[model samples]
Structures are given as C-alpha cells and as structure tokens.
Target: MSPGKTASLQLPSFLHGTYRSVQQKVKREGLRCAEQYRKEGAFPSPRQLLEVPLGEVVVVQGVVDIQHERPVWRLYMVSEVLRDVWEALDWEDSSSVRDAYEASFLETAWGALFFTLARMGAVSAERTARRLEAVLRFWDPLECARYLFKKPGAAQTLEELMVDSCGWAMDAWSPELEGPVRARLESAAKRMERATREDCLEAILRQMPRALAAGHDLKHRQVLADPAFQRERLTMLDTPSFERVSGACTSELLEKLYDWDHELGLQ
Candidate 1:
C-alpha cells in the first residue's frame, strides 16, 4: 500500500505524526532493500525484509513524543495500546520483530512511569484518601475470592490482593499518613483471612467502615499539618455516592468499578 493510505488505514490519530513518519521511513528502507535483492535475482525472505532497525525508529519517535507531552491519561492509553501491540507481535518468530516488540514494551513502561510521576505532582493527599475510600467502599471480597480461586495455583489469596491494592494507595499519600493506612489495611487483611470461605466477603465488607474512618482521621491530621496538601472539594464522581451501610449500593458500585459484563456477570 502507498505510505499515506497505509498510515491512514493502520495508524490511529493518537499515533500519527512522528509514529507515522518513523513507520514510513522503515517501510521505505525495507522496500529499498527488498528491491535491491529482487534485482539480484534472489528474493529475500520476509524476515530479511523486516531486518531493518525498526525498533530504534519506534523508540526514538516514542521518546521524543513522551518528552513533548505531559498528559498522564494520554500516556496511559498509549501505553496500553503499545502493550496490546507487543502481545500481538509475539506470534512472529523473527528476531527483528521480537526486538521491536521489546522496544514497544519499554515505551509502555516509560508511559506508566510518566503517568505515576504526573499523578504524584497533580493529585493531592486528600484526593488520594478519598479515592482510596471509594475503592475500599466497593471492595467485594466474594468476587475477589472467586476470581483468585478460579486461577490455577493462585499464589495470593483475596486478602493479599486487597492489602496490596490498599498499599498502592499509600503511594499517592505523604509518608506520615502511611503508618495508619498500612496498619488498618494489614488488620483488615488479617481479619478477612481468618473468616470462613463463605463469610469472607461479609468480613471484608464489615472492615470497609473502619478503614474509611481511619483514612478520614489520618487525612484530617495530614491536612491539618500541611494545609497545602488538602484537596479541593470533590465532585460526585470523585467520591462514592452511597451510604456506607448499604450493601446494595456497594454491590452496584463494585459492578461498575469492575466493569462487569451484564450478560456474563462478574468475569
């Protein structure tokens, strides 16, 4: 296909400009090499044609774009797309293709790093706390357990995933707030671990209020100490909109959070 037509057909706008430029360069170079081989009365293999250093082109273009932009969400979306592309490319046996996939994967990691750093600078501790509470508010231990158990030879239980998720939330906060949050999460994990399989979800749900209460206390203390860290008031979407005591609310919110397919239930 012509370069312009190929670009329009194969590349999304998010990956246009530099990405298209590099792709066109690689395509031209590869075609030139193939034409030379064809004139020599020997057709080159597909692998030989793809032997051009496409990985370097992709990496250079991606790095330049990353440095020029500061949108974390865009970076995240690009990273996810790159990851999918990398996986899709894995079926190819060529070393050059493998190297290009690796380069794409590295770019994905860079995107994630940029996103984390951006969020660290832009998001406030209070906002982080509220987001954490929102996640825990919809924490469904039954679904977690079911998913984990369904996985063959699962290393960590539902409690571990919950605890680890909570720990990740601590990363968005100041060091002072970590102690209380970690303690509460650990305590919750231990409590859930001790529960019977049938009652595990109930045990986890029961801890939600206490976790939120502790989070609020710690958040208040952090805000009092560093008023600058206090976030502006949140909109309805930023915070959970249901009473803590409502199980039905928690179920609905969890369904939304996990993006459960209505036809398949929680997959």
Candidate 2:
C-alpha cells in the first residue's frame, strides 16, 4: 500500500514560520521518527497527538498531524497508552504507573535544583542537571527506603518509590484519599529506605500489623488527634457572629465521631 498522505495542520500566526515544512518532514519519516523518539524516551501518547487539530492554526504551534506507513502504526501507539492506563485502572502490576510517577518526581526535583543553583550563581543549569543525573545513577530504591524508615515496612506503596522525586510523592494522594492516605504514604517513604520492589509488594498483601500500627500512629498525631486540624472553618470573625454550643451540639458531634466503633480501625 502507498504510505499515508502527509497531513498538514493550519498554523496560527505565531507558528507561521517553518511549521509546514517541519510537519512534512516529520510526516515523511513518521515511523522512523516515532521509533527514534521512543528510543530517546519521548513518549507522547496517541490520545494526546490526536487531540491536536489536523488543520488548525497554531496559537502556540498547536496542531496534531500524523502520517503512518500503515494505519496500524497509529493504532499501535495508541494501544500502548491505553494498555498502561487500563492496567492502572485495574490496579494491576502498577509498576509502570509507579515508574511514570517516579520519573515525574525526578523532573520536579531536577527543575528545582536547576533554579536554586542557577539563582545562587553556583552552577550553570546544564552542569547542575548533569550532577543530578549523576547522583541518580547510583540511586537504588531499596537503599532509599532503608534510610528513610528506620523501622521500615517490608513493602512500599506506589508513591514510596518516588520519595526522592518530591513531585511524584506530592501527587500520591488523590482528593478521595487525602487524609489517612498521607500517613500511609509517609510510611511508604519510610520503607523506601530499605525495601525492594518485591519486598514492598509482599508487605502490602501480608498487611503487617506493625506497618498498619506505624501508619496509624503517624496518622493520629498528624491528621486526627487535634480537632483543630479536622475542623473546617466556615466563617470569618469579621463576617458574622456565631453561636457557641455548650451542650447539644457538642454531644452530637462527639457521638458522630465515635459512631463507627469497629470500623474506625479500617478508616
């Protein structure tokens, strides 16, 4: 079959220069370029590529054009991204997801270091990045776990793997899992100092009482013990006068707090 036609995107005024030629060249060598890009770790998801308008003008050089040796090439690239996302949804393996999260952390850390050192005039961005890269060369996940958690859990959570990568670690909690979730994650960070991928996985399934206890202890102090931390302030002092409840409201609130007796442990 003949190769697919070169698809051109309309460019915005800002992207008027050389974009057409670039797209054509990119299209002409689409498969080769894709392979090279993957080898160099430029994994643009197929969904992301398709989001680009084929003939749209560039507001910021924004357009999506794809030329494939065969339609299957486009299909294949999309399949990979779908596969990873699907696995995450299924809560399976979860390693690739962890890896992506870890990589993001590294990017944040590298960026932060780059700016900090650059501002201090201590090192060039290039040199600072190089040094960070070098440091990561000898970085081992297990060693990190052991160091961080003196009483490390046998298993680390998905976020624990990204402890060194602060950005990824920061994102480990979802809006749904924000409270006790953080304490569990901190526990994972502690584990990362010593545990391996295998060790970490095993520990979770075992549900080590020690691990849970440690996580709960941390969470109590960090998230729950102080009512101040749990209570949401609805109004400001300057806005309105609020009624102070001495009896009924206080009693009701206390009952609600301990209502789920046994389930409190699970929470």
Candidate 3:
C-alpha cells in the first residue's frame, strides 16, 4: 500500500478559454456584423465597427487590425474606436503629463471612455436625445468638460450629465466647449460606480470559471430553475450557465435565494 502521491494538482486554467474562443468567434463576428447593419437599413454605426471585415477581423500585419465587436451591438464600433483614440485614449493618458508639465492627454482610454460615459442613461426625452446624439460622435469638448466636471458622485445626475455630455459632443470637437463650467473642478475625480462596477464584474468573473470550480457539477442547474435567478442569491448564479459563482457570494446570500426558489426569483 505504498503508492499514494496525490499532490501535483496543476489543473485550473479556463479563465475564459483564452477569451472564450475569442468570445465565441467575436460573437459570430458580431452577428455577421449585425446582419450587415440590418441589410443597410442602417443602425449599426460607429462607422460600422471601423468599416469592412464585418466581424472576426483581427488583421494586424501593419500594427493593429482590431475588431472584437459588441458592447450592445458594437456601440458604434465602440464609439468610433474610442473616437479615434481620444487623444491617445486619455484616462489622463499617463506619464503623469510629463510629471505635471501639463500636456500628456490622459489615457487609460480616457479613463475607460469616461467610465463608459458615466453609466449612460435616458429611457426617454426623445429617446435619450437620440441616444445622446449617437453618443457624442466620440468626445473632446475640453475632454467633454473634464468628463462632466470631474466626477461628482460618479454619475447619475442631471440626465446622467446630459447623456454623457451629448455623447461626448457627438464624438469630438473641442474649443473647450466654453462657458459656466465651474461645478466639477476636479477634486481628484474618478469612482464612477466603484470603478465601473469592479471593471464589469471583473470582466464577468474572468469569463466564467465554472461556478468556482471545486466539484463542478452545476451545468446550470436547469437554468437555476428560472424565476429569473430567484431575486438574487448573489444574483442567482448570474447565468450564461451559472457564471462560475463565488464572487464572494453575499447580498445576504442573494436574499436567501429569495425564499428558496420560485425558480430563484429575480424580483
């Protein structure tokens, strides 16, 4: 009985299987580039995710031929490639502006496109002013007035700051959109919903790691019995098949699995 060496466990790898087969072939090349923008009936904008190669086209021979597509149907191709790289995607574009000499252009992709346009809003008001004039074409009006007055309470104020300042002034246009912009004078802004909801729930628990991988048998408990994931047992195993649970499971254990299931009540 001397053969018991069970201690070499190097097994845990699926952190979204290398972008989950490139996020399911970039979501089938963003639904066939959104059905060729609904057969030219329009509505697929952001310059059709940067024109050509509809979906799964990552042709980088020159430098960057990127297009992973789809954040709500390729949000105008991620708002025109972040408005053609908003001053080099400025989240205060680093190098600490040559250590405060003051001309760097702030990037972390404009602090992740200003925390995704301060959590965008407008269910109405003429369809959120035509989706904030198609998301301010791409942003620049004095960096959209320092991302709506340097982040007070980090978003959800004054029509989500006029639909993220008219979708960052329809893409880009700056003569510093001048006038009475005093309210948000940068007291070290940034915190838009706890850093964009923990960076979109850590990119969905690093692309789903099998509901916390121990024994692994939960192949989506019959779609969690389906009362829309029962009022929150920590967001009732957040679907796409029990998205690898354990994100520290509590919201009072998702309100006690909403009284033990009416199909896990997502009330």
Candidate 4:
C-alpha cells in the first residue's frame, strides 16, 4: 500500500476518546500530586489544579524499553523546582500559579510517556496526525499570536504570525539578550513556514532541547535571587526520553495529513 493509504488505514479507534482518556489520567495524577503537596503545606488549594493544555497533549500508547527512570525523575524534579520558585515569588497563595504548576506537571509526565511510546511503535501515525490537527485547532501559533497581540481578526497564517512575533521581539531593550533570541526565532519561523504542519512539528521538536536547557538552568537558580525566574518560567514549558525511534513515523503522518487535506481540496 502507498504510505498515505497505510496511514489512513491505521487510524486508531475513537481517537477523541483515547485523547480524553490520556487527559483524564494526567488530571488524576496531578490531583494526587497536589494532595501530596497540600499535605506538605507546599500547595495551598487543590481547587487550583487546571486541565492540561491541548498543545501539551500528544497521544501515544504502549511502552518502550527506554531508560525512562531518569526522565521521569527529572520531570518531577522540575515540578519541585517550579513549586519552590512560586513560593519564593510569594505567589504560593495565588490560584494562577497553582494552576500553572498543575498544568506543567501534567505536561511533563505525559510528554515523557509520549516520547517513550513513540519510540516503542505505539504511536500510530494516523492517530498522531489526527491528534496534531485537534491540538492545532486551538493551540496553533496563529491563535497564540492573535491572543498575544490582541488581533483576533488579523489576516495571517501561523507562519506569518510567527515571523511577525520574531520581528516584534527584535525591538526588546536588551540588545545582547534579544539579538540571539530574535535571530533564533526568525530562523525558526522561516523554517516552519516551509511545509506548514510538517515543519511545525519539526519546529516543536527543535525547541525541545532549548526548553529543557532553560528548565535545568532555572532549576539551579536561587529562586529568591533570580529576577529572571518569571521570564524564564514563561519559556521553560513542557519533555522526555526514548531510544532512537525512526523519524519515518512522524514523516508519514505529516504526509498523510497533507494528502488528506489535498483530497478535500481545502484552501
């Protein structure tokens, strides 16, 4: 069978339900962790726990024989570090901080699981394509830029929005800091606009290393002394480990999605 047809045939049963199940599992785990935090007097309100964001909910199943122990440990450790930072900020009592931490924890745990599953061949290409589409429906860069810039009616694709955001960042007051950041964002934006969905997935993967490094630095900082913690926290989002998985799975998924779109002849 052709790659596209094979992918189309491999769609998992009830894609929405599978996604929701993962979300619920993450939520339950978050609540359990929050209760532990409350008992330790680190987290004040259980009600502050929020649902995981769509952008962080990648779907995969089964298990890989990867060395997940370290990644899992790192995930919770980052959460602990964030909790400390929140407390240091004197924002421990704030519901917003709690909510953000809850979401972060869920994303970390689930994201690790996802990469492991992907390595194990448990991530179906068709299902992944479907899930990515669903995620992008709400969390696409275009939507984010619109919300950030307060331009909901802006006539721009996600690629354009990304480029514009990069350009806007170039005007930051700190040239030393902003220069590199702006350069990276501009380069990434250009790459991402090349093939739309496929490039977007690659961009997401490319940013993972930077995000992880930022998280590690934040983890080591003296929360009380670091004035950059807040700004860093905004960028240190979402993780994971697995063996060398074939990139073919993701490539096929993207191709299948493109083919499907072409079939529909959508503009």
Candidate 5:
C-alpha cells in the first residue's frame, strides 16, 4: 500500500510474506535512508523494489546495520550481489547443507526476493526463470526445510526459504524443477532421508534418560544434543529454538525419502 507500489500483480502466497518483510524494512528505515538515492535522479522507488529491474534491485547484506551505515543498501553491484549469493551460499552437498544449515537469512533473502518477483510476474518470464536457477542451485531439502517450522524462533528467514522451496514457488511454476537440477534434488532428498533416520536415532537415543525419569522408555522423543553434540557432521539446535531441528520434518520430504513403516531406523 505504500506509494508507487500499486502494481496490480497479486504476489503469490509463497512470496507475499517476504515482500511484506522487505516493505516493512523499507518503511522502517530505508524510507529515511533512500532520500539520498532520490537526489541522484532515476532511482527506482525504494518502497516498492519490485518495480526495479530484476538486474537492478539490490539488498542490504545481512551483516549490515542499516541504522549505522550511511548507505542502506550494499555498494556491491547488482551483478555481484546476485552472483555472490549463490557462490558464497554454496555448501558441500545436501548433507553438508543439512549438517549446519549454514546459509543465513540475510543471505537467503536474496533468493526469496528473486523468487517472489518471478512468481508474482513482476519481471519477465524468461529472466525470472534464469535468475531462479542460480539461486535455487544452492537450495536443497535442508534449504526448503529451513522454513518448515514456526517462524517465531531463529527460523524466520528459513521460513521464507520454505516459501520459495516448498510453497509452490518451485513446484507450481510453468517449468517445474527440470533436467539436472531435478535429478540433483532427488539425489539430495535420498541422502537426507537416510541421514535423517540416523539423525533421529541419535536424537532419540539421547532422550533415553528423560524417558526413564518419566518411568517409561517405550516412546523416545526426538531431541538434539548440547552444543557439545559430538556428531561432527551435525550438532543440536542452537539459540532461539533448541527443542527443534531444522531438517527433522524434511525427512518426510516428497514422502519418498524414508521407508517409515518398516525402516524407522534404530537398527
């Protein structure tokens, strides 16, 4: 509803929240900071970034404090930020991505920005598709899983990824995940499914003591280890939400990862 944001294209559910998040951020701070850009002439409306050319829109780095920085947005060129996101956000593999969920909200939001504009038809179809491919190249089950849980904790950004990854942003598009990437995602899902079973076993094993205190051990809970969690590959959930794991439910991704009925692990 901010001025110049009157583009009638209804943002898809997958992207609406992030679009709002960025809008809120602009209203809160960018509005004040953007005045500098206004004087430069030809600056696109900062309030409605979707109005900017896909190649032109730029976002602040997650590590930046816009309040302190004179320039609210990064000095990085649109080309650089776009390339840096995928290149820097890269993990060893799905297992690598699943292990720590290393990509940060500030980082992944770039992907969401592009994804939203694409889904909303804010940009041309060909360009959106091409841009999304690079961003999503870094996405996986763990990537999508980032948003599967409640956004209240440290996962607000992750929830945003879930919108892009699982909320039909990828699935409902004209050209679904195709060619090498689709194969790559399937392979990643397979690995994560097996790994999660192992993850669950360890998590459940660590919960044996609590079950005993309750005078029963019949049902073991899924739990993460202390920061000292020694799995080497993964550790317990940290900070805002320790009780939950990022990719736990993602084990259920595509409903094809695990043989839940017969192979609940524990062997």
Candidate 6:
C-alpha cells in the first residue's frame, strides 16, 4: 500500500532532484524500483550499482525515515520478500541439506545473501547496526549480522550462521552429486554473465563457488570476459570483500577456481 510514499529519505542538496525522480520510480514500481535504479547505475545518488560481485547495488539503500505500511501490508510484503529470496536462492533441488550444500558451492554465501535480502527493510535492526566509528561512523555489515538478527550466537559471520541454520555445510559431498553441482555452478556463471542487476549480489553469490571444479561446461557461456569466458571477478559479482581472507571468509572458499576441495565439491 503506497510503499514508496514511505521512503522520504533525507537527500543532500545536490541529490534533491535525483531523489525526487527515484521517489517517483519507487512509487510506480515499489521495491521493483531497486532493479530499475540499479540499471540506471544510481541509487539515492549516482553510484555504480553493478561493479562489485559481493558488494553490489548500494546493498541496503540507506533507508532513512522508517515509514512502514499498515500492519497487514507490512506482514504480506515481508512474506513476499521471504518467498522471493528463497526462489532467488534457486538452490539445486536436494534431498538433504548436505546435498544442497554440495550442489551450490556457497552454502554459507547463500546464508549471507539470504539475510541481506530479508533485512533490507527491517527498520529496528537497522537502528541497531554496530557503529564502526573511529572518527566517523559507518555500518559494519558483518558485525551487524548477529545484532540485526537479535541472536547472541547467530554467528561471528553470517555464513556460519546460515550453515548451521540450513544444515547445509555438512562434509558429505560425494561423486554422484557432480551433475547437479556443476549445473548450479554453470547457472551461477550464466547469471554473472547476464548481470542484469535485478537482485544483484543476492542472486549471484549463492551458487558462486570458491573454485572452479571443471570448466567443461563453462568454456563458452561467460559473456562478460574478453573471450566471453567464465569468470566472476570480471563481472558485477566482483567485490573487494570477496577477495579478502579474514575470519569472515573460510580458507577453502578462496581456493583456486579449479581447486576441487572447495566446500561444495571435495569438502
């Protein structure tokens, strides 16, 4: 019910005009405006929306002015976002959580993407975002994971939390799972190639692998590379955060693309 009407965020003096236009777009399209604005390569202001693989599309849209719709509308919209996120996951069909993990390389990455999409509009959690102030403060996306979820042991990293929640991080990967696993990986590569920036990062990182198992299926479809090769970094899926090997990212998750011990395959 008039969702965009609630988005009266404070605009800097220069962005007043752009914000007005964005408002109109949001009004017409609701959350669907996220995709349109993404294509325009701007958010509340002019910013590259599709450049980063892990950090794409202005993440949370700096939601100021916590104006939510009526109770029923808010509830329904929340549920819709849940359903959309699940389909967005598009996890290869699996009989067990362990099978699901093997089918999709980023079992934990799926968790990260899932939480971000779910909290995209949660005002209370946004209020509690851990302030990273040395001199100036900013939102620490990683730290906020547990705080936002209001669970003490949700995780040090969202991926870990997701692994536990989905029970998908099991070390039960096997040879029989190869077909579906490669299918999901190729699917991820295809999405990165298209790079429509619809759901942006949430759409790509779930199936994204830490390493390439076999490029047999991927030799042709990576549309973003010079030879139209399969690579995530050259595309919008490339984010600086994904490159770093901190406590946030698992060691195996950063192995060579062709490295098979990657959690989804060998682990």
Each candidate structure's TM-score, on Cα atoms with residue i matched to residue i, is: 0.22, 0.19, 0.18, 0.22, 0.24, 0.20
- Scanning candidate 6 in windows of ten residues, the lowest lDDT window is 127-136
- Candidate 2 Cα errors over 4 Å, as ranges: 1-41, 44-179, 196-205, 208-267
Off by over 4 Å in 1: 1-68, 71-82, 85-179, 193-195, 204-267
Please, what are the lDDT tens digits per residue for candidate 2 over residues 138-232? 23221221111112223333133234333222222121235543344444334433444334233322322222233332323333333343232
lDDT of 4 at 185: 43
- Candidate 6 residue-wise lDDT, 1-267, digit = tens: 123332121211211123334344324332332343335522222221211122211112223213322110111122232233234334233123222222231122222333323322211111111110110111123223231122322222333332332111111111123343323323332333343333333322332442232234433223322212323442433344332211111122323233422322533
- Where model 5 places Cα greater than 4 Å from the true spot, the runs are 1-28, 41-118, 121-124, 137-145, 148-267
> Sorted by lDDT, highest first, which candidate order results?
4, 5, 1, 2, 3, 6
lDDT of each: 0.30, 0.28, 0.27, 0.31, 0.31, 0.26
Minimal lDDT window, size 10, model 1: 48-57
Global CA lDDT computed for model 2: 0.28
TM-score of 6: 0.20
Cα shift from native, residue 174, model 3 (Å): 27
In terms of TM-score, which candidate is strongest?
5
Which of candidates 1 and 4 is the stronger one according to lDDT? 4
Tell me how far the alpha carbon of residue 241 in candidate 6 is from the true structure, in angstroms, after superposition: 36
Q: Global CA lDDT of candidate 1, please?
A: 0.30
- Indicate the residue-level lDDT of 48 in model 6: 18
Please identify model 4 stretches exceeding 4 Å from their true place. Answer: 1-17, 41-92, 99-167, 171-267
Q: Report residue 91 deviation for candidate 2 (angstroms).
A: 23
Error of 5 at 238 (Å): 52
